[model samples]
Target: MSRSFVKMNGLGNDFVVVEARGAPFRPTPEEVRAIADRESGIGCDQLIAIEPTANADAFMRIWNADGSEVSACGNATRCVGWLLMQAKGDGRATIETLAGLLTTWAAGPRAVTVDMGAPGLGWRDIPMAEDMDTRGVELQVGPIDAPHLHTPGCVSMGNPHVVFFVANAELAPVREVGPMIEHHLLFPEGVNVGFCEVREPDRIRLRVWERGAGETKACGTGACAAVVAASRRGLAKRRATVTLDGGDLKIDWREDDGHVLMSGPVAVEFTGVLP
Candidate 1:
């Protein structure tokens, strides 16, 4: 049977969203891969399924391009949040995910702000293979004389992330080193990698190599992780603007509540049905 879907994007991280709140819509891993195929399928960084939740506005299920089911997706959350608010004709909405419950609100006509909640910093929370300091784990790349990337800060914004502070984001060798670190033994369940360049205390430049999605135009969770990591390292303020490949995001790590708020724009690409 065919299914209807909506295409949306938060920044340039796109998704094909299917609503199955009233009925079951389980797609096999192979099916998800086919739908995410850039050439033959609808093409998207991830596939989202919106299902009814007992405690929140809706439940969001995320599947990466590689057909891997993940716990969280910040960009996709914003997109789904905007859609839910629009449908309800309300400015606020809540979404439940494998990560947890997230609250969202309309920032503007096309913009949204999501409360991503507190980040997990413990090595066990990031579920690292061994216990280590998350602020600067003992992982490095390149020769002993000069490592290309080392001592990355790890954080779990629902999912696992490792942020590498680089002098220049453009020279971070994301394409070359991303896959290697993603599959490294340290992160037994794998991880998303972010190479960030702090331009100013209030501004940053970032690029992400998402697990299962390769390099995307943007990553919402990565941006949140970057800010949290940078703040912990005294590289940036608790609140700052993160500039990704697609656009900009305002991230605030609120001290009072310990919630990370992510504000950005969302766009509707189109709508369609599965064949």
Candidate 2:
């Protein structure tokens, strides 16, 4: 049999959005892994599935390269918005995921805007072992001064995240410290970790190590989580620009509606049939 997939990317974090709505086959974890493999398959950071939705545009499911299903993906969600917009010939998209229903709009020029819904701030939401304050939880990884970085603000952007507001962005030892903290004992389910530096009240620098996906070029939910962590700590405003290693994304956690809005561009790299 044959399979069809679309190559898509939000910022630089890319995915293979497979529309298996009416197809004969649903991709197995092994198949998804093959498709995400750089040496064998299509080579994407993640794989997305657009399935049926009872009352929404479609169901957006995210699978990491390792074949683990993830709760949410902001950039891939925008890519879904772009694809669905083209299908309906309109400029809006509403997608259902494990997180919830998300509303999206097309911004001018290459960007699409998505209402990612409000973040869930709690130990259980972030799925920590115990209940700690969301603003700043006591989490010590390695040491103190030369420590392996600690005290992260835990939040859930449909999935779990731990954001560390640091004094430096580039020198924070993300590659070393991130993997350790991600699998720390407190986060029994494992967690996506973000290192953030507040450049301004409306701008921040972010680097992320995602659960099941490692350190990708970019991450939308990580950016949203960083913004929320900063906002809760009074370090940043609700509306802020988050600069990732791949590119920049605008996030607005609306005060009135309590929805987190993310704006970024998605690129369709290529498409092909699966054997």
Candidate 3:
């Protein structure tokens, strides 16, 4: 049977969204890989299945291009929220995931704001291999005396992430070092690697190498995690405008609520039926 799918993106981080509310859409790892193949199939950074839910408006199941089923994706969340709001003709929508329940609201035309919940700061939360300060884990990438990248801040915004403060985001060795750190023993569950350059107290530049998707144009949760990491390191404020390769995102780690709010634009590229 053929199924309809929507191609959407948030700051160029694209997705293949399939509405599975009426029926379950469970694809095997091999099938997911085929659909995400850029050369032969409908390519996307992630594949999203919007399943029916009793608590929230819907349950979002996510799989990376590599066919790894993950817990959370902030950019995809905004895209899904927009779809639900557009369907209901409302301004707000709730989405449930393995990470937790997320509340989203229409910020403006083609833009949505998602409350990504509180970040996990404890070592156990990130589930590191051993006890270490999440503010700055003791890991180096260069020589023993003078390391190139050391002491990255770890945070779990539904998924494990490590943010390395750099002088220039563009110069950071993302492709060279990202894969090494992502599968490092410190992060037993694998981790998203972020290279963040703080331009101002309220502004920053970022680049991310996702765990299973390699480097993407933008990562919503990565942007949120970058702000939190910068704030904890005293390099940036609690709220900041994160400039990604594709575009900019407004990330606010609220002091009162302790929840991270990510705001960005969503776009629908095209729609088609999957064979």
Give Cα distance to truth, residue 110, candidate 3, Å.
Answer: 0.4
CA error at residue 27 for candidate 3, angstroms:
0.4
Residue-pair clashes per candidate, as listed?
0, 0, 0
Q: What is the TM-score of each candidate against the true structure?
A: 0.99, 0.96, 0.99
Candidate lDDT scores, in order, read: 0.95, 0.87, 0.97
* Poorest stretch of ten by lDDT in candidate 2: 140-149
Off by over 4 Å in 2: 144-148
**Cα lDDT for residue 54, candidate 1:** 96
lDDT of 3 at 1: 71
lDDT of 3 by residue, 1-275 (tens): 78999999999999999999988999999999999999999999999999999999999999999999999999999999999999999999999999999999999999999999999999999879999999999998999999999999999999999999999999999999999998999999999999999999999999999999999999999999999999999999999999999999999999998999999999999999997
Q: Model 3: residues >4 Å from true position, as ranges?
A: none
Q: What is the lDDT of residue 192 in candidate 3?
A: 98
